[model samples]
Target: EKEKKEKKERKEITPEEIMKPYGVSVDNIDDDEVRVLTKENLYDTLLSLAAPVRQLRLDNSEKEDRESGRRVVIGMVGYPNVGKSSTINVLYGSKKVAVAATPGKTKHFQTLFIGEDIFLCDCPGLVFPSFISTKADMICNGLLPIDQMRDHRPPISLVCQRVSRESLEHVYNIAIPKPAPHLPPDTIPSPDDLLNSYARARGHMSVQGRPDESRAARIILKDFVNGKILSVVPPPILMNGLDAHGLQKLTKDFNLIGTKPAPIEDQDKEKKRKNRLLNQQRGQRQYTDEDEMDRMVRLDSVGHHQGGKRGGKNFVQNKNSNKPWLEMKRAQKAQKRAKKKR
Candidate 1:
């Protein structure tokens, strides 16, 4: 009876209770041992990792090889084509490291000297286990090459889902099929629709005059890899900090939308200019000798028909030769003749 009563009194712990000890808000976090360093704040990130300031000492037994009586070795590791070598070059103040756009350019590890006692160890770029949701995410982050990908639909679909549809349409100067008010948001255009739109806009057609979706997919993937599509995925932990709308605003603030493509108004103006030029070219086309000869023959035929005795040949008339206007003129002439006869 006592055990039953105790078991009944025990409360069930929810997920919120479990996460309480780790601190629930982003504001609660203060200090960090490691940070994501970018080109914009490379110096700040390096300074954060520096050793604590110490007073100068007169110790004679210190090693002569250790410059400034201090030494620090920093290991820079990331996936291929992530600007690891470029970061090192920036730190060294010169092109001490070879940077290439291709993956796996640095086959071996390299040690770069940044300061008298500071050294940067550039490890070979290697893929590690990560919480990647799909192949599209990898391609978008430049971890996978677009050409090597067999099916580009999944990545394209993911891009359509995460990226702002308006921004994409504006950037590509194409329309994105919108969902109906009664239907769910899933009614938006699929990967195939987007690919087709791109193919049509760029005139990438197959032998059958159909949009070449495969080629269009390749171009879209290339844009994503080149940062023309600026969508980024935040870590799962930071996700709780904002709602869906807030997250979208944050993405906008980051300028993740690609601005390479021209605006819709500019595209319209350019298209109109091209059409005007085409019309001018068509009007300026000189008549060939055959065309001139055909014109002369037509004029001679009209002149001969004016007074020639045509039986059945004159009966056959063109349907669109101002028939309505000719009938009206004929009625007026008949009215004038009847008045004269009266």
Candidate 2:
């Protein structure tokens, strides 16, 4: 009777109960010590992280006490375009390292100092082979530039998998258009459906009046990396993860765009209206073929193509996509090889 009662009281462990939350945890550092640094308390955070290292440096430099204090080097490491340079600039209070929205901008590591007490070693962003799951994930995380993407489908699909479609609609302020035949009321929008709606809303369409999937994908990926489309991953300990309803609630609570902003005054509204009109006028103005040709000539004269893509992406930027000269050289080599064989 006692054994039966105990057995009945015991709860069975479900598969969903076994998984932990996804996050970084350093064993050496106290939970209190690990913090998300912001622009406001960045210096303090840096100093705190470097405290032990700085102390060791000071102890070693004690013999040379007659000289100036030695600086402790803090190496900044992460995947490309993860904002290493931006963090350093914030710490140094200047544009000490070149910063851009794209990946692989910082080709080389740079050594910089802060107030003779802390030395910042900014390393070029690196992507680990093992950590990479898909190209779309990399692009969505800002490890790859959206413009250089040949295909946007995989990554957009990954986005839908990680985040709910309704959350995307909220972020982009768009609704999926009703199908000719109604889907179940509970049916969710597919990534393609979302992209089509997004493209239409953003006016990203092809010359043929079709929604440009590539352009829409790029825009969606950009918004995602910029934190407009956020995925609410519950910590492993948080109730075995959130369901669709729970996720929807979480998204609504955490989504910045979901919140309503205060009404703008008439003066501010008028200024915005004027700006909108100006932009419309500028966009409406069309250039003739001759004008375009002349503009291209002028741009070439100023060495516009010399630097390649923005943010020092000279290495990865393709200068000649067609590669006519390369193809000709390959053909000549092949001809010579065939003649020799004969």
Candidate 3:
């Protein structure tokens, strides 16, 4: 089946065959985009990649490595035609039975090997969103515009040229149907024209009676990126992370290694902070003035100064007398009653 598909692609006309490229390279992009590569391939590509992403997440409890204790999951990620599949294939060699480029090439996820120690996961390309900020979801189908790109955006023609490997004729070759009729000489169509023709041929009409080729081109590129239309899956990984200290590098690279792991006093400070927060939460903790405490002390002094005799009488009979007989007797009797009560 793969052989037949490759043969069919070989025979089909693509847009790259017609256009000429102004020398430039789009090789620096590393985003594994595919969903909204364009509106055309959005639905199919999303459907293709999503099933596998979910499956892998559920596959296992990625326990730490026995030797290095690092949880390792390495997947191939890159733009379409960046030799992603080829690289993976080179890694695994011929052991993994199924590897091929589907229509729009790499639409599905395939699990391959890393010699015998690791797992190599192959996924569909991610379609970067265009136009505006897109929700990371399936329904939008990666349908974003060039305006959403960071730094700069190329013209539509430029994007097509790059995507088709600097050949408009190549793209036209793939787009034109087999056994197509001869059109007039000098009626040679441009890349945009060919795209428009294909868009019209496929019936993508707008309310303004235009072909909407821009939409069509975006769709084509997006689909190819996602492997929704056709692409190749590369081989497996040769040297797993287990060999070159990949696991060691991952495990000990955290900010918490070899530094004596912060003192217990730091924890105590954290506890104090948390307690302060709790008190604040209950509206019970705040600064208090010494003036209130001083006032309370003053009140106790004044109470002592006003004698306990209720009538405001002093123990001494006269103002100057040290003591009076009756007063002394009453005080002693009152003290005795207080002791009895205690």
Candidate 4:
């Protein structure tokens, strides 16, 4: 009876009875710093996973003279006509690079060595999903200058449609309404004839009548010239591929259109700017510091910054799209939950 009663009492133990022995042990599990279930892990778990890897990030050092690494050598890579040359031209404050209304104007890896140590490398515009996947190969011949792309760019297949002799002939028909230069002046048909001919060739048939040639021409031109119909932009890694350093250095000090930066310039510049501002402000406390006086003084003193929109980006900037997309890769690795350093 004693043994049976002892067994029954042990079986009837409550929830608290089983857990109290290991309570402190379970809460503070750490064997040689291999941790488990710490309170810090409960929050910011996703942030720990999503944050960028920073350990091997190259320590960007600045050199003022003609030293080895004074500037950030950035190569603008994107689809043809995505504003590669225009960007380079504006960056160095000169039209050293070519800007045209046609596609594929820049054909060289034109390196403009701007200011001491700062070199602006203007590469040819690359076309994506074309001959290959690497940026170097597409740009090997020259940069493909495409139209200014806002959104989805048109497909090359559509570009093929617009490259026909008939479309050019049609535009000449409606706009000029006369014989084409390529064709004889006397033999050239009326604009309506050319439109009808184009429509018949493309097989545009209306429900009540023959094919609508004018509408067909408009549709073809829309796809070729306008991006509303398609959204294909170029890739950087063309058929040529990236070099070892080009591949490695893309981690921290990297950017392009379609990306954002943390902001640059030294803490000293910030301090000096603030001091100059404070001095100007203190001087202006009295009516003697007239608006015209301050303006004239600044016009002579600093020159440009206090003025309107000087050196600020006036247009939308373009950048590489693949880098951010590649951040979440797993074989790539993850990091320990960042300890909020005291």
As for model 4, its CA RMSD to the true structure in angstroms is: 35.4
Q: Where does candidate 3 stray beyond 4 Å?
A: 1-71, 95-104, 130-342
Which is the better candidate, 2 or 3, if ranked by lDDT? 2
Q: Highest lDDT, which number?
A: 2
lDDT of 1 by residue, 80-183 (tens): 89988888888767898888876677889888776565678988787764677777777767777677889888888877766666556756777555667898
Q: What would the per-residue lDDT of candidate 4 be over residues 1-342, giving only the tens digit for each residue?
A: 966765565444332332343242324434565544333452233234323322112234333532554343556677676677876665546677888746677778877664453455777766666657543223221232232322211222333222322233433222213456787543424435445544544445453345475475455444444432222221332214544333222211121211222223354654464455545445555445355444544344342332234378454322322234233322133332333332
Candidate 4 local lDDT, residue 297: 44
Which candidate, 2 or 4, would have the higher lDDT against the true structure? 2
lDDT of each: 0.65, 0.67, 0.41, 0.42
- 60-146, model 2: which lDDT tens digit per residue? 776666244455678989988877899889876788889887888898878988866777898998888689888877887788888
- How many pairs of residues in model 1 come into backbone collision? 1
Error of 1 at 96 (Å): 1.7
TM-score of each: 0.51, 0.55, 0.23, 0.27
lDDT tens readout by residue for model 3, 228-265: 33221111231331332332222222212212222122
> Highest TM-score: which candidate?
2
Write the number of the candidate with greater lDDT, choosing between 1 and 4: 1
Better of 3 and 4 by lDDT: 4
